[model samples]
Target: MERIVLPGDVVWEREVFASGTWVKDGITYAKVPGMLRDEKFIPLEMAYRPKVGDNVVGIVVDERNAGYMVDLNLPYNGVIPTRKVRISLRLGGMVYGKIAFVDEVGNVDIGEVDKLPAGKLITVPASKVPRIIGKKSSMLNQIRDISGSSVFVGNNGYIWIGQKGNMQLVMKALDLIIRRAHTTGLTDQVAKYLDENR
Candidate 1:
């Protein structure tokens, strides 16, 4: 049966919670509002949680002798050590990398850092990132192909587009995907929309 679930609502009886959900007292609870269909829970909205090996988009917020502090759209900021980056870090510059470590309280250490060129930045609900990328990044590639704009999506919901001209169209496509993430054939729909609109 499909039903609406709110935060803290019991979604399952298990020790370990799913990626976007949480566990309390040996029971799983929905961390965000969404639908529970059959035995699966679909989160409609979710915040970014730092995890090792996740690729993220961040903005350089502060510089340090060791490295720099990056705002990763998380409650706690992330850091990139000097050795991982080649360019001179500047305040407000965009960076991309894989999270190398996450401390006990959500602090993250990012690795393989690379500077991203000037682009328009957009944010979406973190839970919708998977839908935006689609299977094997087919949706992302299609958007790029149709719009002819460079695009990068982070697990944290920050998106970078190489150009601003087509970003409006891209955002529209993203909105559709986010709203219909649970639906089938969304990739095909997005592809058609982008091709026709672009």
Candidate 2:
């Protein structure tokens, strides 16, 4: 049975609380409406908010005197300072960078980026990245091996597929993973799909 909780609802003591949860005194409370699954609170819905150390795929939308303004696929644009950039990027160029910091006011700082080569870019929900990668990158490796494509999965949910063999199959597998991320036995399903199709 699933335990659905609303904001401010008191939870049992000693239960570990994850993000979107808080504890006051000896009791824990939900900070968002969600279901308790495997002792983790999975929110009903949420946005992809950038956090420090998150690798993201950003496009150079505009170049500023100080640096480049990157589109992080978020509400706010991220700034990649000139000093942090090792290579020059042109407008519309895509790069893989890490979020160095996010201020309290929600401004983001991007750093340590590498220019991506020409490839197909696919975007999925950031929350589904872990499932796509699977345990210790098992799923990712499977796709890479079967498709012969170099895959880069950003923490922000931007996936870059380089090289060309079985591109369609790769995209199909990724779509399946994203669409069914919440379902159980996903790894086995993906593996089976790949084997059968191959």
Question: Which candidate has the highest lDDT of all?
Answer: 1
Q: Cα lDDT of all candidates, in order?
A: 0.85, 0.82
* Model 2, span 56-107: residue lDDT tens: 8877899888889988878878998887666689898888888998999878
| Candidate 2 accuracy as lDDT | 0.82
Off by over 4 Å in 2: 1-17, 24-26, 31-35
lDDT per residue (tens digit) for residues 130-182 in model 1:
88988899999998877778889999988888864687888889888988887
- Cα TM-score per model: 0.85, 0.85
- Between which residue pairs do clashes occur in model 1? none
Q: What is the C-alpha RMSD of each candidate to the true structure, in Å?
A: 2.5, 2.5
